[model samples]
Each structure stands twice: as C-alpha cells, then as structure tokens.
Target chain A: AQSVTQLDSHVSVSEGTPVLLRCNYSSSYSPSLFWYVQHPNKGLQLLLKYTSAATLVKGINGFEAEFKKSETSFHLTKPSAHMSDAAEYFCVVSDRFSGYSTLTFGKGTMLLVSP
Target chain B: EPEVTQTPSHQVTQMGQEVILRCVPISNHLYFYWYRQILGQKVEFLVSFYNNEISEKSEIFDDQFSVERPDGSNFTLKIRSTKLEDSAMYFCASSGDYEQYFGPGTRLTVT
Candidate 1:
C-alpha cells in the first residue's frame, strides 16, 4: 500500500519570501515521489520527481524538493515565492518496486502568495 | 513541447444522462489514465490503461465508468449514467514512462 500526507492544508507566504510545503509518505515497497502544482481550473503540472536517483530534485519555476529516506519526507521548497506561485500543490507517491504506475495523491496544500 | 489535450472544457448534463469526455494524449505516450477532483476534495484516480486494456482501477471506477481508446490518438472516458455526485473535474493524463502529463480537464456538472 502507498499513501501520502501533505502536512499543511494551507500556507501563506509573502512575495519574494521562502516557501515550504511538507509531505510524508508510507509505502511497503520502494517509492517514487512527485510534486505537482495546479492553477485554478488548470490541469496538474509536474514540478519534480524523486525516483531514487538524487535526494535533491529541482523542477521548473524555481521549485525544488528534497527526499529524506529516514524521515519518509519529500518537502517542496522555493527560494522566493512569487505571486504566480499561488496555487494548490499535491504530493504523490507510486510504488516503483511493484511495477505499476498507479499513483496515490495527498489532499494537497493551497499556497497563497501575497504581495 | 507535447501536452495532453481534453475536449469540452465544461459540460452540463441531467441526472441519469450519459457523457463522454475526450482526450488526446502526448503523441508517443503509451500509458493513459483518468482522475477526478470533486469540489474542495482530493484528486482521485479512476483508472489506468495500457496495451489497449485496463491495467488498474480504483473503487470509484464503478460499472458506470468506462475508458476506451477508440482510435490511435484519442482516449475517452464514458459515464453510462451520471449521478449528482459524479459532478467534478475529470482529468486525462498520459505518460511514456513515470511522469504523466495531464490535460486541462473537463468540468462535468450533473443536475
């Protein structure tokens, strides 16, 4: 079984300030993690993924996430938040070892970037 | 840059009516999937298709929900009889490997 928990339901950050969205996972097998952002009425856009290749993964729009094995966490971060960064973010997990592509998604965190 | 495309950005239907959501995934991708997000809720996976058949499905993908690749380029999700609860945003996605690219989604409102 695989599941993901996004710790924050909502996060507020000022423009040009740092941003953090926390996520934790539980999986019986080796897991692949991903971060996706969804603008209002838009489709999900992949931010980055951790397929066990590197612990620190960088994605588009100045977004990045670090995977921690010991803590079972993959937290998304951005050096400086922009007004355009306001959106809903989801943390997803898939069991790569199981050979299936089905993904389990978290409830999501709504990021509010204010100027 | 290749991206998934979905038709009928929004649809309004009566209860018990049938609706078909259309999608054209990335040209070279083999895996296709359907997911839904109810208002103020999490995105839920409906089904995954590969090799012309269903690879996996979630509990929400009941008998009324079906998926098909009628042609080489088009993937579709059909609801035989939509209920009020079926009103949500339906997203179509496709992937060549592990990273799935999603479409804008179809908003189905069952009244």
Candidate 2:
C-alpha cells in the first residue's frame, strides 16, 4: 500500500516570494513521488517527479522538489511564486516497479498567489 | 509534446441515464487509467487498463462502471446507470514507464 499526505490544505503567498508545499508518504515498495498542478478547469500537469535517481528534481515553471528519504518527505519549492502558479497542487505516490503502478494521491494544497 | 485527449469536456445527464466518457491516449503507450475527483475531494483512481483488459481497479469502480479499449485509438468508460453521487471530473491518462500524461477531463454531472 502506498499513500501520500499534503501538510497544507491552503497556502497563501505574495508574488515573487518563496513557496513551499509539504508532502509525506508511506509505501510498501520503493515509491516514486510526484507533484502535479491543476489550474482552473484544466487537467493535471506534471510539475516534477522523483524516481530515486536525484534527490533534488527540477521541473517546469521554476518549480523543484527534494526527496528526503530520511524524513519520508517530498516537499515542493519555488524560489519565487508567480501569479500563474496559483493552483491546486497534488502530491502523488506510486510503486517504482511497474507502468501499471496505481497512484495514491493526497488531498491537494491550494496555492493562492497575491501581488 | 504528445498529450492525452478527452471528449465532450462537459456532460449533464439525468439520474439513471447512461453516459460514456471518451479518451484518446498518447500513441504507443501501453497503459491507460481513469481517475476522478469530486468537488473539494482528492483525486481517486478508478481503474487501469492494459492489453485490452483491466489490470486493476479500485472499489469505486463498481459493477455500473466499465472500461473498454474498443479500437486502436479510443479508450472509454461507461456508466450503465449514473447516480447523483457520480458527478465528478473524470480524467483519462496514458503512461509509459516513468510518467503518465493526463487529459483535460470530462466533467460529469448527474442530476
């Protein structure tokens, strides 16, 4: 079994300020962690993923996340938040072995960016 | 970049009516999946399909729900009798080994 938990349900940040969304996961297998962002009425876009190669993974839109094995955490961070970054973010986990990996998702963190 | 595509972006149906949600996954991907998000809720996996059959399914994918890869390009989910509780945003996805690409979802409203 694999599960994920997003620490914050809502995160408010000023544009150009820093952003952080925390996630922790538990799995029976070596899991792959991912951050996905969904804009209003839009589909989920993969922000980044960690498959055990690099501890720190960079993604589009200046977003990045560091997978901390010691902490069982994969926290998303952006040095500067953009207005367009305001969206609902989901932390997802899956088994590393299969393309048929069943994704377990956390209740999302809604990011509100203000100017 | 290739992306998954879903049809009828939104659908409104009466309770007990049947509805079909359509998708065209990224070509050459061997795995397909369906997930749904209710309002203010977490995204939940429904089912995963591979090799023209169901590989795995969550409990939420009950008897009323079925999946089909009837042709080469189209994958579909059919609800034999939709209930008011079935209202959600249904997303279709296709994946290779490392990543899954999702479609823009079909908003299903059963009134």
Candidate 3:
C-alpha cells in the first residue's frame, strides 16, 4: 500500500517570499512521487515528479522539490511566491515495484499567495 | 501538445436518471482512469482501465458505475442511477507511466 500525507492544509505567503509545502509518503516498495497544481476552474496540472532518479526535481513555474528517503519526505519549495501561485496543490505517490499504475493522492494544501 | 479531452463539460440530470461521461485520451496512451471531486472535497479515485479491461477500482465504484472502451478511441463511464450525492466534478486521465495527463473535466449536477 502507498499513501501520501500533506502536512499543512493551508499555507499563506507574501509575493517574493519563499514558499514551502510539506509532504511525506509511505510505500511498501520503491515509490514514484509527483506534485500537481490546480488553478481555479482548471484541471489538475503536473508540476514535477520524482521517479527515483534525482533527489531534487525541478518543475514548471519556478518550483522544485527534493525527495528524501530517510526522512520519508518530498517537500515542494519555491524561491519566491507569486499571486498567480495561489491554488490547490496535491502530493501523489505510486508503487514502482507494482509497475506504477495506480496513484494515491494527499488531502492537498491550499496555497494563498498575497501581494 | 496532445491532451485528454472530455465531453459534456457540464451536465444536469434529475435524480434516478442515468448519465454517461465520455473521454478521449491521448492518441497513443494505453492506460485510462476516472476520478471525481465532490464540492469542497479532495479528489477520489474511481477506476482505472487498460488493455480493454478494468485494472483497479475503488469502493465508490459500485454496481451503479461501469466503464467501457466501446470503441478504439472513446472511453465512457455510465452511472446506472444517479442520486443527489452523485453530483461532482469528474476528471479523466491517461498515462503511459509516471506522469498522467488529465482532461478539463465534466461537472455533473444531479438535481
């Protein structure tokens, strides 16, 4: 079984400030992790993914995340926040050993970026 | 860029009526999935399909729900008898591996 936990339900930051959204996962086998963002009235969009290649993964819109096996974390970070960044973010996990078919999603974190 | 497409962006049906949602995944993708998000709630998986059969399904996908690849291109989800609680935003996704592409979504309202 694989599961993802998004530590915070909501995160608020001012424009130009650093942003962080924490996520932790548990899986029986090798895991594949992903970050998805959803804007108002829009479908979910992939931000970045960790397929056990590199620990640090860079994504679109100046966002990135680092996968830490020891800590069971895959925290998303951004150098600076933008008003357009306000949206819902989800952390997803899948079992690679199981052929990476099904995915389990976190409850999600609602980001509020203020200018 | 190739992307998933879903029909009936919004549908309104009476309680007990049946509804069918359609999706056309990326041309070459082999795996397809259906997920739903109730108003103000997290998205939940409903079912996944591949190779002309269902691969996995959640508890929410009971007898009332069914999926079919009826043709070479279109994938459809049929709800036998929808209730008020059935209202939600349905999203269709297709993936070959680690990353999946999603459709705009179908907003169903069971009144």
Candidate 4:
C-alpha cells in the first residue's frame, strides 16, 4: 500500500517570504513521490518528482522539494513566495509494486500568498 | 509542448442522466487515466487504461462508470447514471512513462 499525507491543510505566507509544504508517505516498496499544484479551476501541474534519483529536486516556478528517506518526508519549498504561487498543492505517491502504478494523493494544502 | 485536452469543460445534468466526458491525451502517450476531485476533497483515482483495456480501477469506478477509446485520438469516460455524489471535477490524464500530464478537467454538476 502507498499513501501520502500533507501535514498542512492551509498555509499562509507573505509575498517574498519562504514557503514550505510538508508531506509524509508510507509505502511498502520504494516509491515515486511528486508534488503537484492546482490553480483555481485549473488542472493539476506537476511541480517536481523524486524517483530515487536525487534527494533534492527542482521544479518549475522556482519550486523545489527534498526527499528525506529517514524522515519518510518530501517537503516542498520555495525561497520566495510570489502572489502567483497561491494555489492548492498535493502530495502524491506511487510504486510500481502496486497493481497498476496507481497514484495516491494527499488531501492537499491550500497556500495563500499575500502581499 | 504537448498537453492533454478535455471537452465539455462544464456540464450540468439531472440525476440518473447519462454523461460522457471526452479527452484527447498527448499524441504519443499510451497510458490513460481518469480521476475525480469532489469539492474540498482529495483527488481520487477512478481508472487506468492501457492496451485498449482497463488496467486497474478503484471502487469508486462502479458499474455505472465505463471508459473507452473510441478512436485513435479520443478517450472517453461515461457515466450510465450520474448521481448527486458524482458531481465533481473529472480529470483525464495520459503518460508515456511515469509522469502523467493532466487535462483541465470537466466539472460535472448533477442536480
């Protein structure tokens, strides 16, 4: 079984400040972890993924995440939050061992960026 | 850049009515999937299709839910009888490898 949990349901940050969205996962096998962002009424956009390639992964829009094996966590971070960064972010986990590589998503954390 | 596309961006239907959501995935992708997000809830995987058949499906994809690739370019999801609880955003996705590209989604509102 593979699952992910986004620690924060809502995160508020001022523009130009750092942003952090925490996620933890449980998987019986090595898992592929991803972070996706969804703007209001828009489709999910992949922000980054960790497939055991690198501990720290960089994504578009100045977003990045570090996969911590010991902590069982993949936390998204952005050095500076922009107003356009306000959106709902989801943490997803998938492992090939699962029947069809099904992706399990977290409940999502809504980020609010204020100027 | 190639991206997935979905039709009927929003649909309003009566309970028990049938609805079809259309999608055109990235041209060369082989794997297709359907997912839904209820208001204020997590995105739930409904089904995954490959090689012209269902590879896997979730409990939510009951008998009423079906998927088809009627043509080379089109992938569709059909709801035989939509219920109020079926009202949600349906997303279509396709992937060549591990990274799936998602469509904008169709908002189905069953009244």
Model number with the top lDDT: 2
**Residue pairs in steric clash, candidate 2?**
none
Error of 4 at A97 (Å): 9.1
DockQ scores for all the models shown?
Answer: 0.60, 0.79, 0.52, 0.58
Chain B, TM-score, each prediction?
0.99, 0.98, 0.98, 0.99
Best by TM-score: 2
lDDT for A111 in candidate 1 is 100
- Please give, for residues A18-86, the per-residue lDDT of candidate 1 as tens digits: 999999999998789999999997889999998988899999999999999999999999999999999
lDDT over C-alpha atoms for residue B77 of model 2: 99
Local accuracy of candidate 2 as per-residue lDDT tens digits, A32-102:
99999999988899999898888999999999999998899999999999999999999999986567677
What digit string (tens of lDDT, one per residue) describes model 1 on residues B5-94? Answer: 999999999999999999999998889999999988888999999999999899999999999999889999999999999999999999
TM-score of the first chain in candidate 2 relative to the native first chain: 0.97
Model 4: per-residue lDDT, tens digit, A6-106? 99999999999999999999999998999999998788999998888889999999999999999999999999999999999999999863224678999
Q: Retained native contacts per candidate, as fractions?
A: 0.61, 0.80, 0.34, 0.64
TM-scores for chain A, candidates in order?
A: 0.96, 0.97, 0.96, 0.95
- The segments of candidate 3 whose C-alpha lies over 4 angstroms from its true place after superposition are A97-100
lDDT of 4 by residue, B1-111 (tens): 899999999999999999999999999988999999999899999999999999999999999999999988999999999999999999999988678889999999999
Alpha carbon deviation, residue B28, candidate 4 (Å): 0.1
Residue A77 in candidate 1, Cα distance off native in Å = 0.6
Summed backbone clashes in each candidate are 0, 0, 0, 0
